[model samples]
Target: MPPGTPFTVVYELDDECALELANKTVHGVCHLGWVPAADGDYELRMAVLVKPNGFLGRLYMAGIKPFRYGLVYPAMTRQWESRWRNRNRSGGARPR
Candidate 1:
């Protein structure tokens, strides 16, 4: 998201949807997808498919994988949950 190409909607269907973007820096293609659980809660997942041009790209990804998984992703999930709660309190549209 940092000065990267805008995210484009990749797929939309009853069960799931995804948005993907290409970065200009160390990262390559990335996508975040959402699907509904059997219990009626939504589950989110992110995938980073690397097209590492050289050693640097690969190293960068490896170095950041821990931080990404441990910090960034969990924070993102919490933020999403908070937003959903706020929306529900304000009578926002039902989360699909």
Candidate 2:
């Protein structure tokens, strides 16, 4: 997604499914526990965080444990989605 665009956390708990995509940006951290296929190993369940720029995304996905992924992910997403529809309105009727 674009800078300052947040996302609301939609936690997935499915078995043997991989590659849950990020909203707009091309890549995202893989929740390792989310099994890629049947009989797959337990990897990791990511909290899906986003950086202001792509650079941070790379640093994060590259296993930068120093940063706190648990805290930042869901918060920003909520903010982004709250503002997203308003920001991209195509002349729709305003809510009463």
Which prediction has the highest lDDT against the true structure?
1
Tens-digit lDDT string for candidate 1 (1-96): 224436566774433345565554443444454567799887665666656546777777788889988997688656644554465577765556
Worst 10 residues of 1 by lDDT: 12-21
Clash count for each candidate, listed in order shown = 0, 11
Of the candidates shown, which would achieve the greatest TM-score relative to the real structure? 1
For each candidate in turn, the TM-score is 0.53, 0.25
Candidate 2 local lDDT, 1-96, one digit each (tens): 344434323343332212334643234443323323355533223344344337655655556444444545455445433443354376633221
Give the residue spans of candidate 2 off by over 4 A: 3-27, 30-70, 88-96
Full-model lDDT, candidate 1: 0.59
lDDT of 2 at 87: 42
